[model samples]
Target: TVPGIGPVYTAGIVAEIGDISRFKNHNALAKFAGLTWRQHQSSKFSAEDIPLTRSGNYYLRYYLIEAA
Candidate 1:
């Protein structure tokens, strides 16, 4: 077993993300999964309590949090 990666979840994640290579890097992957936190910036002053955007693959996000 791979830590928290249950067989069923692994299958679902892999099936959802057909081509991992489509993502350029880890940041891209996280963004696709909706795991990246949002940011609000203005002339070098940034907000820290911004919320996460709901514009990504929810299925992938579920698996990611489960794995964590």
Candidate 2:
């Protein structure tokens, strides 16, 4: 078994994402779970990116955060 992942957390993540290989990379995985932050920009200057996107699976996000 992987370190730091107990049964419940592992089960929850697996249940949410059936096939991990479907994601091309970590960014894809994060996007699927809605854990990526939004890119903010104005006319001439790009704003500081600080907020997470509202979209994504809340359950998966919660589990991922908990695992971290």
lDDT of 1 by residue, 41-60 (tens): 99999998888887699998
Overall local distance difference test of candidate 1: 0.87
Q: Model 2 over residues 1-68: C-alpha lDDT tens digits?
A: 87788999999999998889999999998998998888877788787847888588888988888888
For every candidate in turn, the CA RMSD to the true structure comes to 1.3, 1.8
TM-score of each: 0.85, 0.81
Off by over 4 Å in 2: 1-3
Poorest stretch of ten by lDDT in candidate 1? 46-55
Model 2: pairs clashing at backbone N, Cα or C within 3 Å: none
Pairs of colliding residues, candidate 1: none
